[model samples]
Target: MTFDPTLFLPDDLLERIRERAPIHDRENTFPEQDLAELRAAGYLSILVPTERGGAGLSLEQAAILQQRLATASPATALAINMHLVWTGVAKVFSDRGVPGLEFVQDGAVAGDVFAFGISEAGNDLVLFGSDTEATPQGDGAYSFTGTKIFTSLAPVWTKLGLHGLDTTSPDGPKLVFAFIDRTDAVTTSDDWDTLGMRATQSRTTRIDGAVAAAEHVVRRIDPGPGADPIIFGIFSVFELLLASVYTGVARRALDLAVQTAQKRTSKKTGLAYSQDPDIRWRIADMSLAYEALPPQIAALARDVDEQADHGALWFTLLSGTKHRAVTMAKHVVDQAVLTAGGGAYFSSNELSRLYRDVLAGMFHPSDPESAHSAAASALLGPLQG
Candidate 1:
């Protein structure tokens, strides 16, 4: 059952992606070519079942492949994460005998791209609350109206998986999770200008009267966090995949540092920097931090696939893994940039782009604060209020 992860990421194809990454970043454009090739390669349906005409890869396998993809281009991996999150959630639901998300499975098999639209401005109650309003149509459908920020894959996502608040329901205020296809009512803003992950084209999205049909309405749950399968599916899949990408970034940075250390020579000593004690120590330190992440990701992802219960500790494990992966990636890239010397300071350098790309990790869900809170809660119980 164990397969080589590298087999999913052929070096020649990855080299093409890697070559275009900088150009996409420079131009502040989406990786259209990257998306095309990945779609052609059936990567968009990695989580869909074999019966659904997909590769039928498990979450652990998908995580490994994501890490490999990120080593070539982090933005591409991150953007694609949105689509995979939906498919992964569908897989989770299907595995648990949950209904209502069959659309995701069907869509992915048909080559549809799904974008995550759970984030909102100033709304930190992620998965528990929403600023967008979902008006009940009384026939199982709902019309959503609000702006979704950080909508990755904004340029080409065929369906958006988002949540909104439904205050009109007789059941009182409930968070509504649904899928909306791209329609005239949905608008994507071209305001994705940023310092990192620029190739994602994760622009602002405005949905005005965007409706999720009766069948597309997936979950209607109470507005705060609880033991909801949808929430668990989202958090587990998102965190694991996000962590995988950053882990790949860390590995790439560590490898680059090794290569730089070996190639750069010290003019005064007439020896390669790899021979220097300080350079060797730095590389060793980076490697030390980098080595622990892949196993952690693989183990956690396998646990998810096998439905292993970590109980209330699930959030802690997921968030902690993501936090550590991002933190380690940043540290490794810092060392790599230092090892690459002044040339890396240029905007065109791969290390420079990576240095910027890694920063966006801190901004994702289960952020540093949330991760610390989850860990603290797991260890000592929730802080006495």
Candidate 2:
């Protein structure tokens, strides 16, 4: 009980749950009391494994407790950064014994294991593909009829990781998962209204027949070298927890752009754009990129947890620390929404939902084409360490 990564955010509760990010992005809602106060203060099992109680962190102490819970809600740290990458790929698929290893109740989270069912239903959300079809049945149980789109938590999750295709062993696709105890086998359609993390209900799950067991289906066994870049897999700790939840929504849009330039007054030099010097160099220039993106993504997640089985050099150091912390959290949340002027897009500004939850770490899964082809094969190696 004593591993304090800012105890998952406590300094008057991270500026009071970052003032509830503009009413959970204007009711596209689902912070659910900031994820039930970050899973009732266990801080969502920080990499769930110390023989399954967890806090066995070390993806550089779970990227400093996911950059202190994305400083305070980068859309609930990108909807709980895929529950620390589905519990670190379910603790390396339960130490390689692999069959399902279903331990989410290690202390009942009730939701989280976060989304990415690999898009379907007339797919084309920018083409990094998969179809998800699974239907196998003849007494080993299977029935995952697809349509599962974006799926960031079909109205609250309880662990999920599904990618189907199995109408009874018609092979090559089977990673199944579910603890969904009937949302009637999953159904959600309102295509996650987008343009940003908008409270990240990132929806669309629709399964009709989500049955499980064939030991709840767990088949992603990459001992390595599918040319190694899965950013070293579990999406490189979700691209360093989506660059520390977009550097905690660019440090809460640089503290609401330095409290709206010290409470406005500048109708052209009527002064007090916090005594402008180019709005105090864009609010002290996003506090030096929020104090240097949590120590360079905690030293590249401690060199990928000290070479966790060197999976292609921890997928080229978690894809060059998520391409330099999502290109420095997109120039520190677009210069904290232009030092929050034009009332930072008034939906009752909170730097307009930290300028839309810091652009969900700019095309997450550490975009920029797998961080420049894993930094050009880790500075050009004959790499496979």
Candidate 3:
């Protein structure tokens, strides 16, 4: 009845996610049960309009919910983010009265899982340029052919929201943003083995001729970045949700560090490690680094919900927030591990997994380099050629 995130994502559900997280990570498997539970709880429809039979939550609410979810299982939260991104994008467009992605919202309510199929190997021009070919069918259809790497939700996605280059179209050199149903032409490779976030199962996808029907094509924008509503929506939602997940990871790690410090008694001090000045200081450092992220994510998400435009500055702010959240999460986790001592160094330790998971933050979109570049461009100006 209410829009309370905690009500939707209760502690009991989170406890289940937390309990199963290690098993999924160790098995290098997708958290199918987590997906099932979330789906049953209507989590997948959080961003859909209430008129469309969904929770109709704002981005700020979704961000907070995702942070709570991530505190239980970062991999599950990250995996589901691909789905949420599509719904969030659709919500953004609908909120702005641009009406085309209604089907995305509708499909989410119908229990369709949407995978984000944008990342390509060595393609740093994320969401701007694409190596995938969108061969036009002359009848308002396009058959995409390319290898899309890091395709999260690979095993269970019902639809894929992707972008590709349409070089031979009448509108030549346009980037086609569309959603294609999973078909025989699409192949998911079992190549998700990685350093961490193993439960994500973000495998490589090889597409020979994935077709997007006329009604499914959402946007046709010029190659390279611009002020397209679709692009802005994707960037805003993606970065904010991402920042929230890593921020949650930091929170979990910080809590674990405190627990370890409080429970463990030091031989020299004859008291709990929490009393040790160095341990306390390290925890404080982790806290100091961790505390500023949630309010920032909340404020920016509120801005998005309110349609408060910052024009060209949005990219800088969004990317910078993601960059800061990730970097800060990693720093906090590092300090947490230090405070946790030798026990955390063991592979079986939760702190050890958190350390590995936090490392993955650097690799997502708005990498440190890109974030700095965007921020610099915003503050100073684009670097002289």
Candidate 4:
């Protein structure tokens, strides 16, 4: 059967999201209405299997949908990206015949919202290590106690998939991956005010002895990077979806630039700016930058879906793709702002909002510095000890 994104997110829904984006950005509030609409559309479960009562879409399809959503509302798309990451991980597990995360798929089908709580302040070794502590309860359950920063979907997530260090385990130290429901032990801070993507309200969460039931505890692997499917699943899905969001931002910026060029007339030439060689060149430059990302994202996403063995080159490719998407999106948006001229300087201008929102790409996982380091190591081998 053919999978159509519009079947789930029709044009009217996207138009509504686009109209509300600026309001959400101005108010700095979570997009509750958007979330409600997306949930109704079963968007949160797109990555779940068909038998599990979801759209049963592949990671590649999900990436395409994310890009479309981001073009309408980047914050809404970014907030939902966290939920999709968890479901995408569950899909990863199912594809590999791994057990234990079936519950996540079921939860998604049952309308549960999952938030990514893996980020930490000052934890440069993301996905490889952790500062949060995960103590075992003698049974299979574990108690998590630590603070998680940038906890997206903070105002609404029913469950949080996070990792913490389990130091007292017999294996010395292991990174415990688990899920915990919102309880008294979890305190969400009301401090999500930011320069952009404000509607995400990705506030700080302090987990004070939050318990993951025995069944919810998924993995306990040694820290500092390995071939664990859990790690690979999170990193792969997170990077690609993030890249999709930024790519959508670039697409929207390009469209706006073209529209402005065609609509605004040049006083000097008595013609539309689109007719001017310099304006045409700027728009063409933006197009060149924007055109490279979607296909790159599509190829990498397809590799993840097919489980293509890029082997050690996987991280290099994934991180590099994300880095390129963000840089290209920023460049396109900058050109767009230039093309749009003084009117774009207003806060109400969509291009102005995009300019602020695209900056967040730099702060997500696989920053340019890390991306470069990974590429360098992939080519030159690790620095000598």
Best by lDDT: 4
Give a tens-digit lDDT track for model 3, residues 33-148: 99999999999999999999999899999999989998899999999999999999999999999978999999999999999999999999989999999988888888899999
Question: Each candidate: what lDDT?
Answer: 0.93, 0.63, 0.93, 0.95
Q: Is candidate 2 or candidate 4 better by lDDT?
A: 4
**What ranges in model 3 sit over 4 Å off?**
1-3
lDDT of 3 at 68: 90
lDDT of 1 by residue, 259-304 (tens): 8888989998999999999999999999999999999999999999
Query: TM-scores of the models, in the given order?
Result: 0.99, 0.35, 0.98, 0.99
How many residue-pair clashes does candidate 2 contain?
5
Write the number of the candidate with greater TM-score, choosing between 1 and 2.
1
The sequence of per-residue lDDT tens digits that candidate 2 reaches over residues 28-109 is 7777787777777767776666656666565667666666666666667777776666665554445444445445526334
RMSD of each: 0.9, 17.7, 1.2, 0.8
Q: What is the RMSD of candidate 4?
A: 0.8
After TM-score superposition, the amount by which residue 341's alpha carbon in candidate 3 deviates from its true location, in angstroms, is 0.9
Candidate with the larger TM-score of 2 and 3: 3
Clashing pairs in 3: none
Decreasing lDDT order of the candidates: 4, 1, 3, 2
Q: What is the alpha-carbon lDDT for the whole of candidate 1?
A: 0.93
